[model samples]
Target: METSDQNAAVDALKDPEAFSVIIDRYRYQLSRYIQRLGAFDSDTTKDLLQESFIKVYLNLNDYKPSLSFSSWIYRITHNEVMMHFRYMRNRAQAFASEDALTLFESIPDELDIAVESDARLRSMHIAKALQRLKPEYREILVLRFFEGKSYDEISDILEMAPGTVATYIARGKMALGKVLQEMNITSV
Candidate 1:
């Protein structure tokens, strides 16, 4: 049977080796999330993931049962990425092509492309448009759409009020739509 994240956390607190379960469960999703946040390259994403996981391990005691474990972990990962951007004194760079393709594919319901070839062509445009968005909008949209987070989860992860999370998501979607329109790709 699959152990719950809460159970894994409690176990890890008692037996450090049990932390491996937490790591195994979160590793791939968090790695993809780190990359989607525009970590430059695989090495950068790996470094950030290592640092974030270390933080998660060290702060295991701080995990409140009130928040979902996924939200709490995502919060840590988000903070790590923000700190990396601040340290580098640069904004998020464009996502790698594969990341872009995956991101666009994840939101097909919102961006209804009729053909696979058109989807491929529009993926590049969408990536550039996303790159052009305000960091706040981009991050919120990424969390909401690509990461498949609910508003409450986003609120917990972003430490924002639920209403504020909803507002940001609305504005972010509008901004993304406007950007795509400006690119003359209005299928969305």
Candidate 2:
């Protein structure tokens, strides 16, 4: 695969289709990226995804070709998402504005609960047990089991040392297994 730096350099020249290629290449990954950042299929997430790409393109020239484009793009997406959250935090105080709010209120409460409960079925009994874990542990479990990404990939994505990633996965699995027993979920 071509590096983000290479893509960025091409995109920096304002090549008509180059930026679009980058978008096509990264859009699925970018969508998953936003989902992991806690955005759903609402207008807010949709707007954020659009804004993140524009931000990436506008700043493409600033990217050093030495870095992984994947990480760089993610960093941009991460920053934008975090910034949006920060803005919401500030705006949350100043306004009772329905216009600024996400459409989460449109979701049925029972539906959301059922969906969360269904998430328990993702990892089988073992995965169900893992749901009780802290966010950090749950993250490691999801990145490994649900996404099926490599340790190196998880290491790269999580920005953790490779060995640390391994240790966390091992421990997380053990923790999940323990939880499974407590929940009376038998491992096959």
Highest-scoring model, TM-score: 1
Question: How big is the positional error of residue 145 in model 2, measured in Å on the Cα after superposition?
Answer: 3.8
Least accurate stretch of 10 residues (summed lDDT) in model 2? 103-112
TM-score of each: 0.90, 0.55
Q: Give the TM-score of candidate 2.
A: 0.55
lDDT of 2 by residue, 1-188 (tens): 66455855576567855677777777766665554444344466678888998998888776765556776676687678768867776211211223213212221221112212333243233323433665456566656654555777677667788899888877776666566656765442
> lDDT (0-100) at residue 57 of candidate 2?
87
Q: Taking the tens digit of each residue's C-alpha lDDT, what string does model 1 give over 36-155?
A: 676367889889999999999999999999999999999999999999989998867767777666656545565332323565666667677777888889888888877889889999
For candidate 2, the C-alpha RMSD (Å) to the true structure equals: 9.2
What are the Cα lDDT values of the candidates? 0.82, 0.58
Q: Which stretches of candidate 2 lie over 4 Å from their true place?
A: 1-5, 12-17, 36-39, 78-132, 175-188
Clashing pairs in 2: none
